[model samples]
Target: MTTSDDEEINPVTMLLLDQKDDDVSQPNNNSNIINIAEVVVPTAVEHQSYHLNSITSTLVIRQLPSQGLSFQLWPAATTFVKLLDSYTPSNTDPFSLTVTNAVTSVNCRQRLRILELGSGTGVVGIAASAILGADVTVTDLPHVLPNIEFNADVNKNVVGTRGGGVHVAALSWGKVEEMEGVGREYDMVIGSDVVYHDHLYEPLIQTLKYLLLGDGDGERVFLMAHLRRWKKESGFFKKAKKWFKVDVVHEDGPSGKSRTGVVVYRFARKDAVFR
Candidate 1:
């Protein structure tokens, strides 16, 4: 009689394989388990959203911990900003609707040369361009341009190959005189979620005054989106009114607990000389 040789499988290995096989065979039964496993698995990408200016769109993004990031740009008309007014501060980002509404409210017309200040993710200006059909220039600190440019490139295909404009350049509010080289007075100037720091209030106001066009039959308008903050000392809107006719475009309800107002300010230089 010949001795028969047999291979032995480790119990743990067999159990794992058997489990996997069961998973494959009874897909419906294991669906919940698979979902729970997926949920527990560490994901490289943390989710994010960007407002794209070149096409007037809001882009949803996910940043992979290992790889870089991926984005999908969609028209704001398609993706509405959620109203998270009463949620706990930790659960939401306060600026979403404030910026979206401010951008949507601007009265820009085609060929209404426009400028956006602190164009973070380029949302306000882009929405203005798309809705108002104006050529838009997006300006921010130099460091912020790459993301803005990258987003513009990704969405260019959808917005189209021509007409709307997106130009990126460094524009610290106080440095307006330097940016004069870019040429032309903007018909409309806009900013959103930009005035948090106390030191910035003055410079931000100065930026508006410098960029505003001389009054020529009501062509020049400046719009700002602000949420009331603890940093505000006093007479903030009063000071702003000194330079322009301020209007409260829309105000959030008592539920809007974030310390800012969803405001739209239209500025015209008090001394703007009309032809």
Candidate 2:
């Protein structure tokens, strides 16, 4: 559904009541966005484990709700982990099946290099590093880097064993300097539940523009995993479509009185040229 028309959501913040759910379809409780201002943060530690077929044990991540939204795990991140776990050079399901010459073709080029935006708790990015054996950089605001670093360090054994590595950086979206520093060496960019705050739409777009329309050859893909909470999120997509070709590569059915589940959208340059 994209929750199409006009309204939409993402910031992973701003009036959203962050609830931890295993099966996104069922919420333990329902709360209005307005009252979310009073949402309580549990001091308890939040931990999640993702088992990787390539690794002997599971990848572990710790969430600090007391620190704020940036420290918590979001629903869309889980969806990305699911895809990364089963990714392969020959598998054509989501990458090739829906996105055409996206993922499957990318593996033939070189070692996969991925950049992740707003990597809260560093779950998806860490998982991608180990499972795909792709060198990955996980970035977010300056404050969030420590925690991401912690998670990355904790799983260094797994990443190193798989021949992939994870790097943590501080990237505040919309900062030209930060964007330029990150560079465009990556073949793919990924994010989950990143489009939450309407105010950040332009900044997020600017960062995307710099990276997707970057210097290099071949195709560069941006895969964003999102769960639409408000109809206004359409504005973000509307504005994004103007700069890049946006397509929904994956979607999960609506859960817990919601009309849409986590949706993974592939963004590429309309001309399909990275140079």
Candidate 3:
């Protein structure tokens, strides 16, 4: 029988219990029985680890129920991280200098300053730090900071070794005070799976307007990755286009199957148009 909503059962444990019960009811004389102690008990905390091949760094994350959606590693995050890895200097060592020089000139900095909004498990930010050697600030809601910090701490050594670091901070989009607290501008602003909520459209764009560099130089970049879920979610892109030029930079989905609707967009201020 299936368990009710109020009750939960581990599929592995349930299967083992069913087998034991069947063995007990059988008429055949059999002394052998499965050892209960051998069964592994599931833990409350879920631990996930990802290895970034480009930087040769590993990220360890521990998720909790309190943070809701932020507690788990999302597909968009993985996809963006893979995109970063592909562009990483290490992957193109011989041709890296040319790319690095262009990126540095655009940002006018030796190292990139990156800000990731709604950085749930800090995967993308941490990977950026380790792979690009960019100083990254991973920001999210106040309640999500603990796990973000934990993930940052676990990967601190790797980030440090790469000459990059991560800072965990609380940032609620559209909040004046919070927006003011974040620095004037960042070389690159990145986020994944942050556009799922319909109500956050205005605040998120407002926050982007405040933090994104509007110098009209096109030096700064805002990269966002999200899975297209609802038709209404397109409104975010529509609203964002008013202030920034949005372009699809990358796309990937399962092969020989329907499109997965995962896309990464690169946004930059429309210099001639921006007020």
Task: Specify the highest-lDDT model's number.
Answer: 2
Q: How well does candidate 3 match the true structure in TM-score terms? A: 0.75
Question: Which ten residues in a row are the worst by lDDT in model 1?
Answer: 8-17
Candidate 2 lDDT score relative to the true structure? 0.76
Which has the better lDDT: candidate 2, or candidate 3?
2
For candidate 2, the TM-score is 0.80
Error of 2 at 112 (Å): 1.8
Model 1 segments more than 4 A misplaced = 1-110, 213-218, 231-235, 254-261, 271-275
Please write out the lDDT profile of model 2 over residues 1-275, one tens digit for every residue.
Answer: 34454454333352232344542322222222323469853355656666776465577777766678888777788778877776665665655443334444565746568899999889888888788777899999999999899999999988877678999998999998998788878867889989877899999999999888866633878889888777778789999999988877788886554556888998888876421
Candidate ordering by lDDT (highest first): 2, 3, 1
Q: Please give the distance, in angstroms, between residue 255's alpha carbon in candidate 3 and its true position after superposition.
A: 6.8
Give the lowest summed-lDDT range of ten residues in model 3: 15-24
The TM-scores, one per candidate, come to 0.57, 0.80, 0.75
**Model 1 / residue 168 / CA error / Å:** 1.1
RMSD of each: 19.1, 6.5, 11.9
